[model samples]
Target chain A: MHIPDGYLGPTTCGIFYVAMLPLWVTAAKIVKKTLRAKQVPMLAIGAAFSFVIMMFNVPIPGGTTGHAVGGALVGILLGPWAGCIAITVALVVQALLFGDGGITAIGANCFNMAFVLPFAGYYIYKAISYNASIDAKRRVIAAGIAGYLALNLAAGLTGFEFGIQPFLHKTASGQALYCPYGLNVALPAMLGEHLLVFGWVEAIVTALVIKYLQKQSPEFLEEGRKN
Target chain B: MSKGNNFIEYSIAGALSFLKESIFADEYATKEGFLQSLDPRIKVITFLLFISAILFTKSITISLCLYAICLALAYFSNVNMWFFLKRTWIFIPIFSLFIAIPAIFNIFTPGEVLFTLKLLGLKLIITQQGLFTAVLFVTRVIASVSFAVLLSITTKHFALLKVLRIFGIPQVFVMTLGMCYRYIYLFLEVVENTYLAIKSRVGTRLHYKKGQQIIAWNISSLWHRSYYLNEAVYNAMLSRGYTGEPALLNDFRVKSKDWVWLFFTTVFFVILLYLNRK
Candidate 1:
């Protein structure tokens, strides 16, 4: 789901950077007000948790293992605002220190994973799990559904971003200067794989984690539950 | 862990060290190399400038030239040529192969036909324009990735974190990021130990359902540990006179050499931009 450096034009990257600025600021502000001064350590640990969460390889069927983005899981655990900041920090670390994601595309990658995934997942889970007790099975189901849709939604946006590159930036001879795939190809390619494979991985992991937390420590789920 | 075909296998060591090999090794950053001598802020800014020039230019020649300069920078920075090559090449093929190769065929970008090949009794036309587009996309990726990787390897991670101030990232977030960077390794060790215990206890063959249960247990326990640690860390910080506001030390200074390097990079950037417009 991480867009590499060359796939998107400078304009697209610039636009995302601008677009994410307000979201990030808003997220930080809300997180501070919500968590108070304690937000610092909470967010830092959350960031580390989210970062290492990606390293936990879950065994799937057919003898293969997959890692979850854990964006949705974090959002459900820490609330969307805090989750967004934590995931953003993790992503920044990944891009800058690890070079997993593109440096120029940090804004774009964070927008997809940090903002879109968390907000989408948190809200979807909240909407579905409304009024359910912390220990309810409905909360676990909600988490799974949220994970699947959140990942798909983020993948869709990424595909759209990549698809527009040819139209936005191309040579006079119609050669694509950046990502060459049009919306037709990019959208289906991104959405297809996620819908089939990764979305399920995310869903099972998110659901399993929620189920465990519901049993082990239901207070973790209570933060995002408050009206 | 399993040698069997259907056993649930997780390469914990490989997955955990995936980032550590690059971040923690710091083999090149410690060396008294050319790039290591410069301020990290200057190096990062210069790398960003080079990347911007690469992105702006539509010319494959310009991109490749910048890519060459990136390699030279890495060489001067004391990064091993083979190691650097492996890093760049590994990422590029997995990424560009999917996105770039498709662009080379006539289906994506129809243009003057360069050649045609029969594949499975079907004619596939390769176009000059298509080839140019693909190569341009790839070289842009290579140039940008090389420079980004170059900056990452030559500078210490903490210095790079402090350099985030230049980009206007909040001190708190920077502090958080630094903490996150530090704790990630700690958790990595925990994860390593946990996996090792699991392997020792369960051996190679485990059912997929059991594996899933183990992962859930692992994640939840991790959350519990991090939760307790966060609270303890906060109290520790309070006892040590840490306020809500964080103060990160800036030990970087723009020396004469940094200025000289900046001047040359600016000149190269301008020339590249001019060439890009043509």
Candidate 2:
């Protein structure tokens, strides 16, 4: 989910920015080394694709519809580094253009959605689907499970970020200056929703997309150095 | 003939309406207004300073003052007041309220009990300090989101990208951002057409399972097509003498009015910071 500004104190936001700086540098290096000049457009298109994907309404059970974040799907198609950059670009655009997420919290938001979600999902998918044939049903299951788990992981981290604010930042009289909930409250609130609803939607979306690609355009998956 | 089918159709309609509204919102950014008239770089820097000032201060009075300033700015910028308030308050307050609700309960945040009640053999107390903290949290979040919404609704998206470039964002990052902005509209069109084509063929209702499968297939095909499209786009750029870096035709010039605005904003921020320390 998008964490708006003022939810986390400046200290937490600052630490995340510092933590993300090196990862961003490394991602840029990887993108430069692996992708050729012609493939640069893929990065841009991928980011745009991630942005537009959220607009799509996916049919779920019980006659309702929802959307996926598409971070894991990007990671599965293009490698995690590319996914990171693409999703990060999309997040930046959302903040600056639409004000969906906080500008100050961009670093923390990207750390969750772009870095944590994609990389964790990608690796989890790889680990589960390893040794299975590319067309195996197990691979689809792997994608779904990866999506489910990666989202929860990001959710848990977000909870930690919000939960710690009360403990870490407080005034002289012990009133919370930022988010007021402790870990006990924040973690469960975030984790419950994702684990119950959004996680399943993300899982199904990732699995279905991967399955379609496997049937129609398997080459895209194999050629892109997704591992 | 099924309720599920109607729900799906309604959701698709809702999605399209939301897409149209977003596009409509973009039209406001191009209109001549106070914020629209400022160089985007100056607007970006000044708004960012305002956000930082809001974040740095713990005083609720200062936060509300900043929120009022954002409202004043929006008023001067020719933005619709109702639209601005609705955009800022509708989502952020409700979302923050959900986050802040638990803070008001005594179990999570300890303080003097404002109200105590026994329900189902359980003691529930709303704490005075918790209520204060929750309100403070909501106020700060509201103030922060107000500035963000003001900045976005007044500044054109392309101008925002250019401001990012001016801030020394990496060329690759800026390039990707520029291209992404350019292509989002095209991709949205593709998505709309794909859905419309499916609707035309299937009429009002189709088997739910089949509909999902078709949507998945469409997404995959879109991805595949995008690969080829990227190559074509790159070639087109090359043909037009495009280099690696994007070159914009409009040069940014900050006039004396921008400096005056900047000075006043800086003075306000300094005063807020001083008052916050007190």
Per-candidate TM-scores read 0.96, 0.94
Off by over 4 Å in 2: B1-3, B6-11, B115-124, B204-211
Query: DockQ, in order, for the candidates?
Result: 0.65, 0.63
- lDDT (10s digit) by residue, model 1, range B199-265: 8777557777777778878888888888889878988889988977888877788999999999999
Question: Each candidate: what lDDT?
Answer: 0.85, 0.83
Per DockQ, the best of the predicted structures is 1
Listed per candidate, the RMSD to the true structure in angstroms reads 1.9, 2.3
- Per-residue alpha-carbon lDDT of candidate 2 for residues B136-207, written as tens digits (9 for 90 to 100): 899889988999888888887777887887777787788789898777767777877777777777776655
Specify the CAPRI tier of model 1. medium
Regions of candidate 1 where Cα sits further than 4 Å from its true position: B1-9
How does model 2 do on interface RMSD, in angstroms?
2.1
Judge candidate 1 at residue A26 and give its lDDT: 92
